[model samples]
Target chain A: MSGAEDFLRARGLWRRKPRGEGWLLSDVRLTVRGGQRLAIVGPSGSGKTLLLRALARLDPLDRGEILWRGEAVVGNRVPDFRRHVIYLHQRPVLGEGTVEDSLQAPYRLNVHRASRFDRQRLVEWLRLLGRDAQLLTRRQRELSGGEAQIIALLRAIQLQPQVLLLDEPTAALDADATLAVERLIDVWMRQDDTARATVWVSHDQQQAARVSTKMLALQQGRLQGGGSC
Target chain B: MLNPTYIELDASRVALAALLILVNGAISLALRLGMARTLLVASARTVVQLVLVGMVLQWVFGDRPWFVVLGLLMLMTFIAGVTAVQRNQRRYPGIWTDTMISVWVSSWLITSFALLVVIRDMQPWYQPRYAIPLLGMVLGNTLNGISLGMNALTEALVTRRDEVESLLALGASRWEAAAAAVRHAVRTGMVPIVNAMMVVGVVSLPGMMTGQILAQAEPLQAVKYQIVIMFLVASATGLGTVGVILLGYRRLFNADHQFLYDQISE
Candidate 1:
């Protein structure tokens, strides 16, 4: 229950209809510590993505409180929380520009104004992901889905967020690209901070097992508890 | 300065002017343009509306009451606001309020500033002759701009919700996230006014100048008044468009800065 050591914690999280339908996500409770890769897996329409979005503050929760590092994430602090707790969509959307422009986009925000887009660090991460300097020059629209996904993965990792809420991030990628993403995340986890965490939503049980140390099973919008798979 | 003799149109002259519409209708019918009924109805509607408006203007002009002038402006603003907000294909929550505030503020400010500060000729600031017509012109143009801007913004926000959410997740402020839509809306709104300004003296004779010249006013005097109106309309349209977009984009997100899907109509 100590908040200081917890990376991201959700208490009694639920999303439901105001009038008719049952809960989309119900009474889900989970705590993630630093450096843990937690996989949220469920059948389609089970609200797996909903839980992650709720955690990332991307979706409004009908009932629950999400705490980051033990403090309630609310108000002006929500942006600060978002800066650390980033959400990566399944189909990445890049601004109208080159890949480098997309990579450098985040720095335009006041929250990230103190940080600059380090070209050396971006190149390093791209190299780790089996990409190279030439990839940065390619136009965003010209990129293949897998290449775009890689760029998205790199964009989130480049920000050095504390927790990454990834919703089927590798859904469009090939086996090679998927492996590259997994390897890049592994390297990111082993970086100097050693306090970063990620909650990855995946349909592929095998890939989930390979990528995440702990697994959360969701069925009919309710958590089936840890390791139920 | 040459002495100007004003020629007034009699009832027979007015009826003769109405014959122009029959000629237009004849052309439409002969061409099988399908616009025959629409043109006739529109022509009739214009005659009725103008005659009614002329009577009202004569009353207000004869009296020169400030309240009457201001009341008419307020009425115009209310109609303009409703028209602007309803322009969206699918209306969203709070859109009416957003549009109303934007249209009212921009239209009122620009109209008043142009009439009182810029021109500074009316005996009483709210002189019905000057205030009613000038304010009416500005509000009419501003209505079009705000409507176009709001429609563009709402459509963009609804269609590109994912992109906006992605930007928000990148720690961008709501303004930053909706920057593309805002730019698009403002530019779209301003385009008509810009185009009108570009062709004011070359391609076509604008309504105000044409009206003044027809009323036997000096060409230079009419030109000066037309220039003032054009400037005011452009300023009001730009302001109104930007105002609506600015007020509108914030409403697309909630307190936590998440995109409000419910606010966007399907």
Candidate 2:
């Protein structure tokens, strides 16, 4: 099952409680192939976020290794790995600046030093989402929750990462904003379908069915069932 | 001008000054603050600790060898390190070692520069009378800075865990992710010494300067020494704060750029 098409693979991924108690996530294995939109659905406390974080290598793994393009992701490569496999928090955190500054922030990182912010592309995306270039000039603190999430999503997508581990990116958005986010992700994935994939952790099964071709269910820190929607 | 003679105080005169604690004890009693016992114990401790330190300094100043002087300075550095860490309300693994390294390196470096390069006329650079007092002032101030910086850094890291993690997730190196917190911590640590510098001659007469003046050294000479001490303290504090904060940043994040926020405990 691990093939060239497999962009990211997690085998026997496990994370223990900080106090050395039972596992918060254990024995979870999944594969993300190019052009795959995988949605993980679970009730609260089901470790969906934990699993996504573990996959992104944002959280330490106790029992499993994450493989990128058929090689084990290890030290030194982790930074570059994270650069390609970006994780978006459920509630976005934006620094104190205009939306453009927040978008430009990632390019400042050493990993993305070669990348430049594409202001025109951002404005075009904003037009598609029914926003104008003025949104970029708005102060981040003045942004609505939906606007902040939009900026956060654009920030990650602009980096052109190969994989996105989105932890309920729209959990705080209203219906219209959610649709805008889903549309943006759809457009981004299709732009380079052969090299892109996303793992969405959503509470909305209907939205999951709409956004994902493959769906997985999690419960009590374990995978229960997974199949194409 | 006549040479001014220094007046000496006997134990009886010191005891008379010690009676001032009774005023504090009476206030606590009147207010029913239940702090009278603590007040008495702390005052007693102050007298005992100072007397003990005075005795130790007397013995060391009595023609002690260089090794003995260095040993006493090391001891003072160790105690300052421990005290700095103990003042923290949070804990993490290896924090003590980090604090110790910062305190020892910063204080010793600046103290040595002051003793060797700045005050070159001493027959021996490690003379107890000069080195001990210089190192003590530097160590004391550096301890304050390290304690303040470490506390602020750890607290910011814990409180701003999500912000840090978000930055890490976006491919920020550990240094980039922690830059804001490091700046804040370093600034916090250096504030005291900076403020002391601002008010040194105008708003306050520093204890060392006052002591030198009482010891019949020329007032201008005392001012020069105090000026040197202030600059030494500011440099030591700034260096210690930066060192400890960087060390702490390394501890809180890993080589993979992942934030190990759980390592810290309130």
Candidate 3:
């Protein structure tokens, strides 16, 4: 596999205090190449999630430029950028709806209206993730943490995002479910071309060792790099 | 020591309502320091404002014309807008514009439909004793429904914004994502007024009903007026609340169609 493509290119990233507090991030520079699985590990409140949010443009950056496919994207059009590269929060807040509705939600916005969603591929994804395709008709309440997450991942996958930012995607699942999630991401990563890149925040060293080809650990908000392939 | 008896217009009875306002006001004050000030100021303002409206009604009821009727409609709209923003300003940022237009159109059309078609000659185009108070009650209550309806719906939108954004990310339009919340709010908001309509005569007599009796109007006549006001309140609440909620949606979202967390967040 070629490690040459850069799906997300961020430079000189900074986050200003919302209420004039000190900067959350300052002079942070990073590049995430296409199809690269980078783990951003940190203790709670270490700004790992903030870094992920900045990458996705979900959080404001006081000064910096974030580019998707060489187009400048920052404060404005964060949601638009997200359409191409989805941000998966650890505790994903899905609405009061059936699984199918949650899956089809982003399509409801004008930004994603132009893009066509392939639920047919979703059927395969559901099955591959050890979920029942029939479960789409069922409400979100019926799904377990593991099942719900697979659907969340599938939601991101359906976007066909070039880059995916995952914050504790498997943290809510059990060991068995975590293993299954790790494999699903692993197999998909090896097979999917440079079009799909990922930056995941995980605490588990084993999970990190499983999917990420390279890992970057964060200690108290600074990058401490280590990984096993 | 003199014991105060409740008189319909007795300052004491009025004082009782004043006391209700004071008690509610103080609690409202301590609970919401900012809102407390607004409530007290608004309550005092309401008394002053309503009295001014009462005088205006005396003049308007003497004769009803195209301009006068059309103008009173404007007044009703104004009242509704002020009421909504004052009651719950947070949910309704920049709402005064659309709300003014909406409240005017809906309340005017519905009230007129009832008056012209339903209560044909209860006129001089306006009757302070009848039309004035009727409009006030209906408009005031409808304002509440709109405020509440908008509040609940926007809240649902905020709380479920992720679900909303997810829908938008998928393929749904902004309105469709918000459809559940807005529709639910409008539907539920109309319930108190609607159920009141259903049980108007037997379950409870509306303020206007007991009001007319106190004024020495015939019982049957009072019942008829009560029915009209009930219908007006129900229709006004339903029609006005729905319009306000739907119109308020566009303002609630940013250009990216994301709900403004900064604006709506507590």
Candidate 4:
């Protein structure tokens, strides 16, 4: 697992209990290589979200380090690291603007300054998700939950991140929208499967089986039943 | 120009003014508003505090040495800083020191500039009569601005945690992630001073100008001083608001470009 192919690896990851003694997420280890679809399934309050956030470096780790491409991800490299490894929140947070503005927002950051917003590319991606260019003109506040999730997906995908940490990205969508999201992600993965990967935190085991080739179950902040499906 | 004879108020006249609070007490009693005790305590506090301040100012103004003048100014700045922090509803580690730094730097910097550059005739420049009153006015206004700015910053950070983190996750630097909150806080801190400037003479006669007029100064001279005071206050408030808000932004985020929203507590 400690190879150049390993894109993201967590070793002995620990998150302290927000209050009181001991760990909320204890001594967890995992590896994600290119071309892999890893799914983390766990019950509610099991620190699944904590684990994903820790991997994204959005939250602090108590006593562990995360490596990106066999290099310790640390200060100064964090923004660039986050740029490449985007985290899609469960509930989308769109700024006050049209959908096109939300998509264009990332380019304004200094880390993404080199990347220009390509409207043609976004239109193509939206079409794959059964959305039209008209959706881009609508205000974000007018978006449905499912539409917002789709916008969130396109927002990350447009950046061309190597790893997508999906934290229940479709938990709020209907069956059709969920399938559309899955299809869009499937297309994203197939586009550059060798260099791109995704780690999904999902509640639906059957959906997990359909989307992922490897599964890891978490219970009480401990990893269990790790194996290929 | 002939010096105008200023009418002096005796202690009995001040007592007569104090008796007007009975009207407020009567209203409270009639409405059963449970505020009579509060009104009484506040009035008492105002009298005691002002009388004590008057004595202190008299001593300081009476040919005090430079060190004593400097010491009193420092004490005033420190108290103003503490008062600003106490008015805020949120608490974070090192907030006191941050507030102190903002209040001290902004008020002292503008006050010194006024004494040395603006006024230009302060014999020895640290004369207690000029320095003490100028610094007091600046500190008073800066205190309000710092308090408002700190409150707005902390509240926005807490309520907009998700929005901030989303920007962080999207690869925004700490400044980029917290820019909107900083802007909002700085603007909130500045609004009161800006509004006061908008209506300084037309809507109300400011206390300093009124005091100067009562003390037999020419009305035009008093107006000139009031204009300068307003400008000094506006600058001090702007600098202090920006300083405190930026300090708060540094506290809530880190060098790692992380939004440490957990550090803030209600």
Interface RMSD of 1: 1.1
Give the candidate number with the greatest DockQ.
4
State residue A76's C-alpha deviation in candidate 3, in Å: 11
Candidate 3 stretches with Cα past 4 Å from truth are A1-6, A9-15, A25-31, A54-67, A72-81, A93-142, A203-210, A213-229, B1-131, B158-162, B168-173, B199-235, B246-248
Q: Which stretches of candidate 2 lie over 4 Å from their true place?
A: A1-4, A225-229, B1-4, B19-39, B65-67, B123-125
DockQ of each: 0.66, 0.72, 0.16, 0.74
Interface RMSD of each: 1.1, 1.1, 4.4, 0.9
Q: Lowest-scoring 10 consecutive residues by lDDT in candidate 4 chain B?
A: B1-10
Residue B5 of model 4: what lDDT?
79
* Per-residue error (Å), model 4, residue A191: 1.2
Per-prediction CA RMSD (Å): 3.1, 3.0, 8.5, 2.6
Please, what are the lDDT tens digits per residue for candidate 1 over residues B1-266? Answer: 14446676688998898788889889989999988799888988988999999899888888766787788889988998988777677677788898888888988898889877988887887888888888788888998998888888877887888889898887876667788888998999999999999999899999889989987889999999999999999999999889888877778767777777676674
lDDT of 2 by residue, B73-147 (tens): 999999999999999999899899999999999999999899899987898778899999999999999999999
Query: Against the true structure, whose lDDT is highest?
Result: 2
When summed lDDT is taken over every stretch of 10 residues in candidate 4 chain A, the lowest stretch is: A220-229
Task: Assess chain B of each prediction and give its TM-score.
Answer: 0.91, 0.94, 0.70, 0.94
Reference-based lDDT, residue B130, model 4: 85
Instruction: Flag regions of model 1 displaced more than 4 Å.
Output: A1-4, A18-21, A192-194, A226-229, B1-4
lDDT of 4 at B135: 92
TM per candidate: 0.91, 0.92, 0.67, 0.94
Write model 3 residue lDDT over B80-141, tens digit each, in one string.
78777667636445667767766776677777777677777764555445555656777887
